[model samples]
Target: MLERLDDIDWERLGHAYGTAEDVPEQLRALRSPDAAIREKARWQLYGNIFHQGTRYEATAYAVPFLLELLADPATAEREELVGLLAAIAVGYDEQWLPDGLPIAEHRQQAAGGAELLAAAPHPGDDDFDEDEGDAEYLASLSEDDQDRLYTHVVVAAYDAVRAGVPLLRTLLASEHDLELRVMAGYALSWFPEEAEGSLPVLAGAVTEALEVGATAADGPDHTVLAATALVAIGLLGGAPDPALLDDRRPLVRWGAAIGLARAHGPRADPAVAAELLGWAGGESPSDDRVPFLDGDLAGFAGQALAQLGAGRTVETFDALLRRIPAVSGVEALHVVGEALKLAFPGGALTGDVPFDALDERQRRLVRQLADHEQVWRIDGSYFGNFRLLIGEYGLPDKYVTLRSYAGQG
Candidate 1:
């Protein structure tokens, strides 16, 4: 790895700081015996090379060295290295937003700062149809900004993974280290074309997770890694094992539901689909002092199911609506993403759900939101989708009172 580093013109390669000359030093520091120096080096490498999850020219160049570091027995904090590899490999997913959000304004709204606006639209308003490009509204920026930000990152990740797949597959198969193995699987999921090499290992991880989850009462030390393994397996087009779906552990069940949804979409096994729906509605299995419903399990499950366009679009939407503004609660956007997934398949979840051909209920939802005329506080593409749904499908007229929108601006 060091020999190869000498061949690259680091001055021309770009990370966040505009050049990659300093990256080699950070790579060497990974082998340092000084624990503090090694820690700082890893952080510096991550911040500059993989800054804000955006991959750069230097990122792909760094993958092989990262893998080499992972294989070396002399490396300290190997688990952290595995994590960095996963983060670097994972640039983003297809459903990922194309543009950055105005997070500052959203934060202000969440802090109770409201933006004055025209009176909310009522049912009998003059313009019942929510126009496509309201001058007052800003859509997910003209696709151009998104294209500029991510195209190279996607190319960089793909090029690196395409070359590194064989090495990662070997590492995943032969490594005795559990974290390294799990991370390898996670990284491979980012490159679906490499599934042939990674799926078997992911499948093995599922079996191992079932064993761990089955005996979770005895501490379940590896459940988190196991969950990551399961999710990775699912993302790589592997179906959830029956044993996993049937596992008594709620965590495994939640992960299994996500896997099945990814692998089979709505065509997933009847039992698996039912189980996923239960998860979407925030159900927990086996009472082993587990807190499945109290976390993002339901949120992820709901999103997957929404993508599948299953039976619970409205039911799931209602449940998500009920959970919003719960002072101390999970994210409402998770369910919003799910509701949009099902409610406006190929449209709603991404904020492109149209307003034409809508029945009364969808229309009413739009009208009611317009009546409030409050500036939207949420600033995600998903939130944009939710707003479109209000205009497209029309949220219920009483939507505001239905869930507290306080701190939601």
Candidate 2:
């Protein structure tokens, strides 16, 4: 399957860490009989080619080899293999969640770099001043040019993964490995361009999952397969069969409701909103590994509520408020962000205003969130996104500043 592994000039390609000459060896190790060796190779691959959601020049080159491993039935840990492809295609799904992958716009933006690519001098050209490497050359260019180049690389990686969507569809349809099928379902969700071919298989998976009662003899929650398929359908701009909403399983029902809410947006049935609100405030699914929203069903439900234009409603505000304390760090940040948006759309409460300036409900919501010390105390890499969101609303992102703004200090 990897006969051409050595044929590729991997040394010329670069990953997050350096020359990708070691990538071939890592790929070879994936087929090793030793589980520890395979796992070590997997982490090495992740750290290098697709490190921290940033796809490198080598990432696109590695896609076919990874897909080949996935296709080989003898491959161990096929789920992780498919997941790595998904990560390479889209760095972090959270950035695209509830709205799905912007495949057309992304491709358009990537193609806009054609002029840059054309004008770029070859290695032999006098103007080819990238003596240090691609990084130095990129640093020498204007920010716009740098963005275009990076976007080009990213899109190349994404398209490479997209090329394997048909294979992912096949895997999704296969019943032999339910976990792998579910992983494929999540992976397919990122390739909205392949929706025409993927949706049918995903729909079939939903039906198959339901027919199996989403259960196995050992008691793993096989319902996630159905839920994953439903969410993928919704992310691809399609809705699940409405009849499934009436299915007997709670998880299936949540999937149908969330999928409908995502696909239809504000036009979704009002009942779906009610269902999401309930789920958002209720206990999150026990399976922390459920694909979407990091398995925080409550967090996703809150985000979707905001999407449906129900964020302004008192019900959503209250539900999110109930959910905030139960979650911490980014999960709480997501819930609070939605709550803030719902309470004050279009960056309301940005001007100098006394506590009395806010309406009673807004004041109440702000006070509750401000007092939730858990969400406020978090600090680290993930906090930046939360800070940006809050800043847009003219809210202080720091705990002390927030307390002062809320008139607590």
For TM-score, the strongest prediction is 2
| lDDT for position 287 in model 1 | 29
- Those runs of model 2 whose alpha carbons end farther than 4 Å from true positions after fitting are 112-132, 214-218, 310-312, 348-362, 377-392
Q: Give per-residue CA lDDT, model 2, range 168-282, as digits (tens).
A: 8889887478788889999999987778988889988888888776455665567888888888899888998777777777778788888898888888877788878888887
**Per-residue error at 336 for model 1, in Å?**
3.2
lDDT of each: 0.56, 0.79
State the lDDT of candidate 1 residue by residue for 1-409, as single tens digits: 4667788777655567656789989998988989999999999988988887777667878877877777676777776776677567554332331111222332333231111112222123453223421223213334543343345454555455556677667666676666666566656666666677777877776676566666667653556546656666677667767567776656677667777777776577767667766765653322222122223565666566655654646655555443333212123445544444444554432333344545443443334333333322344222443444444433332345323322122
Query: RMSD for each model, in Å, please?
Result: 14.1, 3.1
Q: What is the Cα-based lDDT of residue 356 in candidate 2?
A: 72
What TM-score against the true fold does each predicted structure earn? 0.65, 0.89
